[model samples]
Target: MAIHPTAVVDPAAAIDASASIGPYAVVSGPAVIGADCILMPAAIVMGHTTLEAGCRVHSHAVVGDMPQDLKYHGEVSYCRIGEGSVVREGATVHRGTLAGTSTIVGKRCLLMTNSHVGHNCELSDDVILVSGSLLGGHVYVGQRAIVSGNAAVHQHVRIGELSLVGIQARITQDVPPFCITDQEGNVVAENRIGMKRAGFSLAERSELRAAFGAIYRDGIGRNAAVQYLRGAMTTDAGRRLLAFYAHDSARGSGMRLYNEANAA
Candidate 1:
């Protein structure tokens, strides 16, 4: 381990040999940092948090802090960050609420600068919270979803897989898969570009288009539209879209129809 002289790390903390602690970083007791991770200047990793291999905690970021929830009562909780993730400058990722609950950040995810992930929030693999995005307590972000800069999600809301939440949007409900919503909470269109960049095949893209049409323009309720999508498209991607549409929360915002697809 290459720990800077100005850094202060607890003797009891488990830091891997391949990790690097930069100047003025402070790692308190009960923290475990894995291989190849980098803790930048003035960053603090405390409590019972575990940073998996290949992760990077940028300058001044704070991880594994106590929950802000009143019900926490000072109980012990864990924060687990998966491999190869990046927690950017000034970001704060708090631990769980109550005992046995975990605040998890999955592999390959990015929590941008100044973003705040509240207690009990879970971000699945490949999730991206843009600069200043704030996820309220107990919020869950599905895999590959992107919450744009300055967006705020309400507590307990679930953003489905591969969805795109536009800049500065306020989300109070679940977002269905492949949907894109704007700042005013309108479903402006589909996340075609995102899916394409994620290596979705042509047929899968077509299926998503068909599914979007069925869900928004078919003159049927969300459930009935999902049923139609299930019957019309048989790909695994199609199934995922239908499942998200079918499981949408009552107060959730619908996806939009933006003008054209942007190449990512």
Candidate 2:
């Protein structure tokens, strides 16, 4: 409703009456701009994208552009920015590569300046991508996970809930929940601070720490580790961690646990 005179919003684009489009911003291709969404100066929202209520597309940021994948042949895919999410300056979020699929940024997620979410990447609620971080196509980032500045996640990798990926890290494997990774993508330790901030009790944190030790420090194989965790886990956090392992990873060999012997 507050579209700037210089903004170029397509007639077919469905913009809510409460939305504000800033100067020189472009909303095109029947994109749905939800209630109270704000397109900052020079932002671009294109393709089959949907900006849910209260979303903010910052200056020079682009959402819902065509995918970067070579497999894409202009199929009708989608990009969805969830309610209350913020895409910061110069960030780019591309649409899905496959037909009828979607790239989803969940509620309250923050994509910092110049960060890139590749085609088909799915980011869960409260996720944070620091400045210049890059997520490859089809990567799935769990809720409350933080990818530090300049980290690059390989395609199809899964970053679990409450995990912290270190700055400039190159993540090629699945990172288990409640963990923290080093620059080389090694799972170094549990995300104690993140868990503490998330309101996990002392007992829950202890249980998770024990689980990590069993899997990473004790040299237990995947089967034995799962069994040990299954019988020992008592808290909701512990169960969630077990469930993360239970799911099949896109990386065929499963996640690699931290090994002190391999550390530099």
Candidate 3:
């Protein structure tokens, strides 16, 4: 372990031999620093936190801090940064609010500068929280989703896979898969560019477009549109969209679908 003289690490903390702790950093209260992890200057990893292999905690970023919830009564919660993830400068990731629970950041994710992940948020692999974005507690960000700069996602909201949330958007409802939201947080269109870059086939993209048309353009109500697509969708991507809608429906939060009437 190449720990700087100015760094403060608790004797009970587990620091891997290949890890590096930079100047003025603090690793306290049994936090586990995995192999090849880097804690940059002034970074803080507090109690019950675990930085998996190859993770980077940038300067002034804090992980595993206690939940900011009133219900948290000194419970032993956890914050876990997955392998190869990067927590950028001044970002804060809080631990879970309930005892024995964890706030999980998945592999290869990026928490951009000044972003905040509240207690119990679960970020899936390849998720990106752009600079200054804020995710409320219990938010679920799907794989490959991008929450744009300064966007604020409400508590318990779900951002779907391959979706792009516009900059500074105020998102209060679940965003569906393969959708791109406007600055007003309305689902404006399918994420054609994102799907293309993700290597989705032309046929799959066409199917998704048709699916979106059914929901947003066809004027058939959301329920009728979903029922139509349930039996008509052919491609895997289309099925995934349907599955997302089904799951959201099961949650009973009643996500508002953006249609022509709402767009006006």
Candidate 4:
């Protein structure tokens, strides 16, 4: 209830008693702001947006705006930010295009300054979108993945768990788990450092490295590699890597060899 007098919250909006709306913030009638959520100066939460408890919308961030898709014609859609997520200054997360659908940002995520998350994107827990990064519509960023500053991800791409995208890289294909793409957007190394930081066991890390080698260095076809890894590698980390390839991504199989040059 610390809403500033300068804030413009619609009478029909559902704002929790403990929520705080700062100066010049706008909350639309259909929007829902949960307990302990904070809307900083000039932030805009409109349309069918819902911010879960403890979420923070920093200054000038805009959520639940209409999607920019040419095919959109104002059918009902939504943008949902999960608990404890923080949308930093000047960032925008667009709503979905199709009726009843929603663009979702998962729990505890961080969207840095000026980042743009296009319509229908799903960002999983602990995902970090660095400053000025742009995610095209329908992109799926997996848990704990980090898209570095100024990088751009193509629509429909899937970035797997614990992956690291280098700064300003242009990502066009699916990036598998525990991998790192170079500035030129080529898969060049295992994200051993990230996995360690995430507390993967030594045995799990060893298995993941073997699985990566089997997929990329073995030179076998994608299907064969997947089958081989599924049976050979039994660690949790190994299973995670296999699961990423089991389903077909927009970029097709062998995501471990994503850029085709595979220098890892």
Candidate 5:
């Protein structure tokens, strides 16, 4: 381990042989640093945290720190950062507040500058929280989801896989997979760009497009529409979309579709 002279690492903390601690970094007791981890200047990793292998924490970032919840009374919570993730400057990842629970950031994820991940949040693999994005406690973000700059997601909200949240959006609802939303949290369109980037086949894309139209334009109830799509569109991708539609997402209720509706 290459710990800077100015860095203060508690003797009880576990630092891997290949880890590097930069100047002014603070690694307190009960913290575990895995191999190839980098803690940059002024970074703080405390509170029963584990930085998995190959993770990089940049300047002034704080991970596994105390949660901001009022109910917290010094429970034995945990924060686990997955392998190869990078936390950028000024980001804060708070640990769980409930006993035996944990805050999790999955492998290869990117937390951009000034982002805040609240206590007990779960971020899946390859997720991206862009600069100034804030996620409230107990939020779950699925794999490959991207929350754009300055977006704020409310507590207990679920953002599904391959979703793209627009810049400055104020999200108070669950966002289904492969969908795009605007600043007002309206489901404006399909996340076509993100789907393409994830290498979805044209057939999958076509089926999803038809499903979107069937639900929003055809004015059918959500379950019936999902059943129809499950029967009519027989692809794996279609099935995944059906599963998302069928899932009980309470916040999705009362959410308006992007299309203009006429009073009948």
Candidate 6:
């Protein structure tokens, strides 16, 4: 480990040989830093946390702080950062509460500058929290999703896979996969760009487009619409989208358009 002379690292902390600690960084008790991770100046890694290999903690970021929950009695919860992730400057990731038990940032995720991920937040692989986003306690974000800058996700909300949350939105409910939650927290459109980036083929994309059309444009009800799409549009993207509609409907309500045209 390349720890700067000015940094304070606890003797009990486990630092991998390949990790680099910058000037004035503080690594407190029971923390584990993995190989090739970088802790920039004045960053703090504390509590029972683990930073996986290739993670980057920028200046003044704080990880593994106790949860903000009133019921938290200092249980030994954790903040787990996965490999190749970036916790940007002044970001704060708090540990989970006894009820939820852990805050997990999956591989290749980005918690942007000044963002706050509260207790029990589960961010899946490739999830991106843009600068200043605040995820309230118990929020779950699925893989490849993007929570845009300054958005506030209410407690227990889930943002589904490949979804996009617009800046400053107040997200109080689940967002379905492959959908775009606009600044008003309404499902404005399908996340077509993100799907393309995730290697969805043209045919697959076409199938999803059809399914979305069926659900939002057709006069059919939600369950009947999903059933129709299942029979008519059979592709990987279509199946995924259908699954999102079904699961999200059961999980909790998403922001549904009042009119069919508004959904499209």
Best-matching candidate per TM-score: 2
The TM-scores, one per candidate, come to 0.92, 0.95, 0.93, 0.94, 0.93, 0.90
Q: How many times do residue backbones clash in model 3?
A: 0
Q: Tens-digit lDDT track for model 6 on 168-246?
A: 9988877877877777787767777788888989998777666656665454565786678678767866776667657
Per-residue lDDT of candidate 4, residues 1-264 (tens digit): 898999999988899999999999999859999999999999999999999999999999999999999989989999999999999999999999999999999999999999999999999999999999999999999999999999999999999999998899988878888898877676767888788889999999888777777667656776887788779878888887888888877766433344324433
Which ten-residue region of model 3 has the weakest summed lDDT?
A: 248-257
Model 2 has an lDDT value of 0.91
Q: Per-residue lDDT of 157-217 in model 5, one digit per residue for the tens?
A: 9898988888999999888778888899877777777788889999988887777666766
Clashes by residue pair, model 1: 187-255, 187-256, 188-256, 188-257, 188-258, 189-256, 189-257
**Residues 76-179, model 3: lDDT tens digits:** 99999999999999999999999899999999999999999999999999999999999999999998999999999888898889999989998888888888
In candidate 4, clashing pairs total: 0
Question: Who is ahead in lDDT, 2 or 4?
Answer: 2
Candidate 6 lDDT for residue 188:
69
Give the candidate order by descending lDDT. 2, 3, 4, 5, 1, 6
Give the Å error, residue 204, model 3.
1.1
Model 2 lDDT at residue 190: 87
Regions more than 4 Å wrong, model 2: 252-264
Higher-lDDT candidate among 4 and 6?
4
Candidate closest to the true structure, highest lDDT: 2
Clash pairs, model 5 backbone: none
| 2 against 5, candidate with superior lDDT | 2
Clashes of each: 7, 0, 0, 0, 0, 0
lDDT for each residue of candidate 2 in 57-163, tens digit (9 for 90 to 100) = 99999999999999999899999999999999999999999999999999999999999999999999999999999999999999999999999999999999999
